[model samples]
Target: MSNTIDREKRLHNRTSFLSNIARQLGRTQPLTQVERPALRHTCQNEVMATFSQDQLKDELVRYTETSLGAKAVVTTKADLEATLKQLCLDYCKDQQGNAAAGETIVSATAALLEMVSPQSLETDEHKVHVWDAAAGFDANIKIAERAKVGIVLAEEALAESGTMVLYSQANQGRAVSLLPEASIFVVAKSNLKPRLTQATALLHQKASQGERIPSCVNFISGPSSTADIELIKVVGVHGPVFATYVVIDDM
Candidate 1:
């Protein structure tokens, strides 16, 4: 009993000393209760809340073209490959304003490889370099920085904002969608949501299912642009100058 008392005394003395040191350093005991600010109520727009799927898609396409200055194309799954190929050829022009021969194209969407073969894009003079993001980290970075065009797959698209969601992972790095001169997204018609709220709910559901969530989720509305300099809007300031969405209906 005496030995136990001694140990308790020593422990108490040490704790007291530590507490004093903490106090000298301007640290105090933690508060039992912390005051938390109340969350502000958010107002929901009725039009976005009640929009039909078809209406939402139309709005998405319209906004993408007019407001965001992004090209949006609707095509059947069968025609996706051909349409995408043509778009690439048209967008990836050379310095002389002609269709370049040796332009590099990077793709985060693995499914696109089979749709538009890399070999098909390559020519004797151009030597088109098509890289799959899944290749490796080094390769992804190299391709992203140098590629004239980058293609990715959209997990979800918000019709109200004309934004497409891209979750970054090993197979889909953020650079593949951001670092290129032109960015293209392949979105399925069924993946289109009316508003950001719906998309957020879906993301929350996925999180609740113990699924692997990516480190970054990008909501790309259009090409990277800003009006900060002299209030003159400039596109491709921070990322791709051009953005395109290819919505596959049959997919």
Candidate 2:
């Protein structure tokens, strides 16, 4: 059949390409595998490796506020809903200081909704929408574009760079964080890691185990910013102008 001939031709081409590469490398054939060499330095993993969970949480807050120019708060699980509501209210206000004048979009993840239901925040002036999988892409994108604030639960928090890691899912679309004017990342204290090294190691482990990784993994470090325009630093150039981290303690 024509399909069978095409498949064989493609495979032959790929093998020929690899053979040429092998010849350039002074090998008769392509290598099946290569062993990893041990490095003389492991400082990347060693930094803050000994810090307790609480200590890491403190470092996360400190780095986020001082270096990243973002807001962060550590609160107990009992006060999480109230803390989130207050923060949302502060960010969703209009120019005239009308409370809840702007709309908000929240990821429909169980970890997030369980902490604070969107229904509790809904009002006549303020509309809170969840990432609705049933509504499909066009509907969700419209809601995210109009929302003033987008909120999602972070899978892990990196202490060194004040970064929040988000593993995209069906109910947690990438637009929920990218399209809004502001982003709220809620992370549990227990999930705070020391740095990006651990986060990458996690992915490596998953790959080794033949587990499917997320289609999109976002490492958001504070608000969107760039300094490329004439070397003058400008904030909120590409994405949300503001970012806030809400760390839930006693989780």
Candidate 3:
């Protein structure tokens, strides 16, 4: 009898709470549909808008190098493969003192995978273990956890903030970029934008065109870092400790 009474009291309280909320909202029935206004920007920076494509790219490189503390390199399509290999050899290393043999994770972007050329990554002297992001989520997570380097392709790069916009998709999992010790993003010159606003606008336009928007969009300005503990400034606390951007000039 007591248990039944307690349950009834709880239900009464919940109904009363909901009734009070509805009363305050001045509506007897829940709203079924609501209209939202379009987004508008009243204040626009003319200077940023007026910059040429070359100027925007230059600013992006400068800010990426100085402000973000990430290596930014400009290469042509022909030299991209060689440049990527050199970067891996420079950064990825193993206990045997061989970088080419280091464990690496590469995103499954068609362009990126084509450039990766796993065969070229392995030489007679050293054979790097390269895993693709297309592997299942759990497998990719494990690979990323132990991988020395992670490679991804950026959809858009914002110059004003030196930010790379990464859309999480099947081919490019978020873990591939976040779980590794170091990350390298390949960005095409045509995808570089003058500001974050422009980049976001483009994404909205894509969505409006009925393109499937990614589950998540990550805007990475630099390597993961924090100064929370005694303000000592630690890097790679929650994500990649080192971030590098390779900008393809002729892409």
Q: Which candidate's TM-score is highest?
A: 2
Task: Give me the displacement of residue 116 in model 3, in angstroms.
Answer: 3.9
* TM-score of model 2 vs. true structure: 0.86
Q: Model 3 — which ten-residue stretch has the worst lDDT?
A: 125-134
lDDT of 2 by residue, 1-251 (tens): 55546555655567778778999989985567566799999999899999999999999999999989999988988898788778778888878777757788999999788878887877677789999999999999999999899999999999999999999899899998889999999999999999999998998777556566798899999999998889987889999999999999897
Candidates sorted on lDDT, descending: 2, 3, 1
lDDT score for candidate 1 against the true structure: 0.75
- Please give each candidate's TM-score: 0.75, 0.86, 0.77
| Alpha-carbon runs more than 4 Å astray in model 3 | 1-41, 44-47, 94-100, 124-134, 229-232
Q: Write the per-residue lDDT of candidate 1 for residues 54-79, one digit (tens) a residue.
A: 66778889999999999999988778
| lDDT at 161, model 2 | 96
The segments of candidate 1 whose C-alpha lies over 4 angstroms from its true place after superposition are 1-47, 95-97, 108-116, 121-135
- Model 3 C-alpha lDDT per residue in residues 1-251, reported as the tens digit of each score: 55546555655566667777888989688534345576485354444787776777899999988977788889988888788777777776665766445666777778777766756755554344445545556876887788777888999888888899998877888877888788888898888887777877777777556555687899998899888889877777888888888899987
Candidate 2 vs candidate 3, lDDT winner: 2
Question: How many residue pairs of model 3 clash at the backbone?
Answer: 0
lDDT for model 2 comes to 0.89
Write out the backbone clash pairs for model 1: 101-126, 102-126
Q: How far is candidate 1 from the true structure (C-alpha RMSD, Å)?
A: 9.6
